[model samples]
Target: MSNRDYSMAFMDGGLGDKAKARYRKRRKALAKTVGMPYVIYGLDQGPGGGNPWDSHVPVIYQDPELLYLTGVNQLNTALLVDPITGADILFLAPHDAKKEFWEGKQLGVGTKAIEKLSKEITGFKDIRYIDDLNEAILEVLKASKKRSIGTFWHEATQGKKRVAQDSNYRFKKQLERLLAKERPSTKVVNIAPQAWDQRLVLDKEDIEDMREANHLTGYCFQDVLVAKKSLKTETDVAGYLNGQLQMRSPFGQSFPSIVAGGKNACVLHYTKNNDPLPKKGLLLLDFGLRWNHMHADISRTIPVSGIYSPLQRVLMDIVLKTQKAVQKATKPGATLDSLNTLAWDTLNGLLEKKVLAKGGLAKLEYETAPHRIGHLIGYQVHEGDPFRNYNDVALKPGMVISNEPGLYGYFELTINRHRYKEWIGIRIEDDLLITGRGCENLSIDIPKTPDEIELLMAALV
Candidate 1:
């Protein structure tokens, strides 16, 4: 199916309609606020090719890759407003031939996909030739009589952190040049508004995509569980999981797959994916996917063997209790502050006497806390907007979030030597969907209960 059909079908009927309605409302609101004769643009879903492996393969399906490149292909899907009334044009980058052969075929500027896009129904103004960009801007400017030209200037590029920082990237330079060139007379509005205390509530499409991603993650986790006992290296497991993501669905591994075992698992964000497999103890997997560009963050810490040792159990209990407490506390109006309060209290309640003796909650430092219980998960893994550090933003319905609370303490005797002697850590994470009443565990199928986890590991044995 085409991307549009796939997106539409994925968004269930009612929800899909709601999304369309919202898009219309957003556009109208923009028009009312900003007026017309303006331009609004957003980052495209980077380089959509046939397969993820093509990224590594030197030569494979080169045609499909080139066919999808849309440079500055502004659909003007959103309202580009100015103070004056003027014509509406969806600014798009026309297909370039030479670039297409060198790169890939040009998917006809907004021509083929504009109808699928939930934007204002209007014909597109193709700016295929970079040479025509100046003329287009001048045309708009002249029509507006240069009376404070306006276009949405979105500086926030999702997942382009590395590219944005690099001063030499072509896209970055072009955008920069546009801003510098237009600043003289035109008014450029930073379209992406930031809310300090808000958490992102999922829209219908967001929920559908996240649900699909969680489904894939749950399956991949099961595969890992079955493969754990037999595996000799962490890299093997990571590759297998990644292979599943690319082969099975439109989804791809959201971030680098982390397959740390034993002591290595304790190190959060361990992406080496090359650690030696452990014979016994925990294999903490804090990985998920970027399904259809949405995120599904999941972490499951399982015993490599079918059973956990007394020490591992103690650590697991602490982390599990903390996770359960946070899950229970997660409801509408529960702030991060309240969630953190619950996490600390639960951890304190579960801490072994030995751990408390060295330094109870009061004595422990920030490293012990290591990571927050959850964050807003969406287009970006740790999505934008809806500030997390505070608790003012109440959890709202349809908002997807991660309820991953973790505690990390190192084994090496060098960093803060007293708190943890053996250097152990535990983290239990799951994706949750906030609803009208409470929350729904999206990653419910993934084994988490002590018995269920043990049963899963037994299968591997």
Candidate 2:
């Protein structure tokens, strides 16, 4: 762990007020729509025993909705909102002086400093210990004649078996069961969609934070690009970029750094940085830096040597052209489905012209480009909706998405008489912010063009 204290910066409370305001507005809207009296959101407690790896090194991940409502980053926290009265209550874990001696300072409830910090960071005046959580829920239920209670309950994407094994999910389910037993008449409803709708649009502060993350991530990427020649292995490059990010910010990489070389680039999300750089092949780096809970997803491919070969240049140009075309078509009101279609058409056009492949565009995309053109980026590396479904969701201002166009060819898969073989796996990813006029490339600072990448690498060599 980097010896940098991100606690202060993380608690600087950038979007706390705005997020609270938005939550208030959403509460009112939900009351009018569903007539729900109160909504409860639980934050994930720092990792516990179920997963051995997680238990060893607990990864603290706050629930996105709860984090939006209350800027509390600590573990074992919950948020309760009463739509009828516009009241917000935050529950905190009881402070243990002994635990603090071993661990760190825990945020104490009702303390003078805690009160001030809560008000500044969460915009909530009422802070109570975890012991009061049950009583507080009971009080809210009794006050509302309807006895209607709302809590987030969404099926785990990974499946019920996985959720059962998850400590956090199990904890949340226990809480839900407790609520059910406490008040049998309580009408429980899922508030996940309401929260998701609100989170879809990024506020001013959210956008600014994303921009800062993108800038910092771009800087680290530039360093890695320039140092490619000196980097002996993929892990070395990942370490260097990680160190650079830590030196500047208290947070770590948004996601696991992907430093794939040569054939490994064909596997999207290849996190095994143990691969060696080929004598002369492409190096695909897909990395991002997380700052202030915001993420910047970026990917760039460059030659292990200072210059791209003839075949590599041809494949890279196709991907770049597809990315440029998609970016040009991206704007407010543009549907992701249309943009994705444009990407497919642009890449397929090259294939038809015998520039990329002989055939098997669909098969190649299915195996390699399994992911969409891009996904919404923000608090999570992959946030909100993806680029699929026709005319489902239209792009709007304040929406940030990725514009990554890629092409991966395996050695077994013959593309142009297998001349290129596994030698080509190129993906050019850049964070894009949708605007009224057009989309702005947040990762533009990092070089993408063949000449630009070669020039930077040459300087370092």
Candidate 3:
């Protein structure tokens, strides 16, 4: 394992109190419509088969005392000024010492460490046995009265599914039965969609962590550009980028690394890294470094030979121009829909000009620009938010969005000959944080200019 202490690496930046206040106002307004806002988080079960404690899974199992403290502290902060009964709030966890020995050492619950970590201002009691859960749930349900009992439900589980031979869906059935019996009057809250949408907009601590990841991501891309000569294959570049990211404080990737070379670059969500780079073609790399679950997403296209060919330059210029326009309009008040529309218009205009100037094809129209110009990047690679149906959800400070503009043109095709097919495909992406005045380009060092990129790459051995 790398020596970098990711957890202790303090991020100097944060969302600030102003952003927190804004979130408070927004959340309060939301709470009025959906009652007081007390949420129960069921700790994730640890991974089996002898894998090191996946930090992604609940660490509450490894150190019950610490996790309990975290839960208690969070609950206290939530109920700070509320008029709700102290006993109504509860932190539920399965306390099994035998299971702890099977996994790892467990910090005993109700210790001084737990108290300090939890910021013990709020009242809470921990139940050791699963048998006590039934009575505890009943008490909470009775106390809730008019206020609905709130709990988050997992929307989906990805990566490997286990099935039982005799009882199909036995795990889910048993879970539902347990929950149903625990509290008959309890109401489950569908925060999955809400969490997904809000994820794009970082909170105080989230921004602090993400900014560090963003800084690292930018610096690492510079390394990629500098060492392009050594990077002959997609896998080679992916490994290089992953090494840079992992060598830093954080030890994992935000999402699967994309290092598509040549025509493979056209594949939007490309993850296959085995392809070899053509001598003088384009390479589109989309990746991110994850820090404390917070991530910074970035994508860049570069010339394989350190200098773009005429056709490569043409496609790159158009994509760059589209991105520039999108960046210009990416203010705090703008929405993704408006940004996407602007990107389309900008790209289409450039395509039209290129066509008319060269007399390539007057009939072709650059209508839709592949994907969205900007998206929320945070906790989850694609952060969660609540505003799904609303197309005009105004942007705000503390929101980090991606400005990815792509141009895909194929050669020797019958449909649209104007689109360059042979040696083309460019996507330049960067993570930007919306500030009070306008925005801050977090991934600033990764070069976009042809001259800057060429000069930087030439310096490397």
TM-score ranking, high to low: 2, 3, 1
Q: Candidate 2 lDDT, tens digit per residue, 64-183? A: 555555555676787666756655677887666686677665565656765566445545677888668878877876776666666664543444453223333455566668667888
List pairs with backbone clashes in candidate 3. 195-384, 196-384, 196-385, 197-384, 197-385, 198-384, 198-385, 199-384, 410-421, 411-421
C-alpha lDDT values of all predictions: 0.56, 0.70, 0.58
Cα-based lDDT at residue 250, candidate 3: 37
Query: Each model's number of backbone clashes?
Result: 9, 0, 10
Each prediction's TM-score against the native? 0.71, 0.85, 0.72
Where's the lowest-lDDT run of ten residues in candidate 1?
63-72
Give the worst 10-residue stretch by lDDT in candidate 3.
73-82
Better model by TM-score, 1 or 2?
A: 2
Give residue 160's error in model 2 in angstroms. Answer: 12
Counting only residues 3 or more apart in sequence or on different chains, how many pairs clash (N, Cα, C under 3 Å) in candidate 3?
10
Name model 1 segments beyond 4 Å from true.
1-88, 97-105, 109-186, 194-199, 352-368, 385-392, 410-421
Task: Please give the lDDT score at residue 27 for candidate 2.
Answer: 51
Q: What is the lDDT of residue 451 in candidate 2?
A: 93
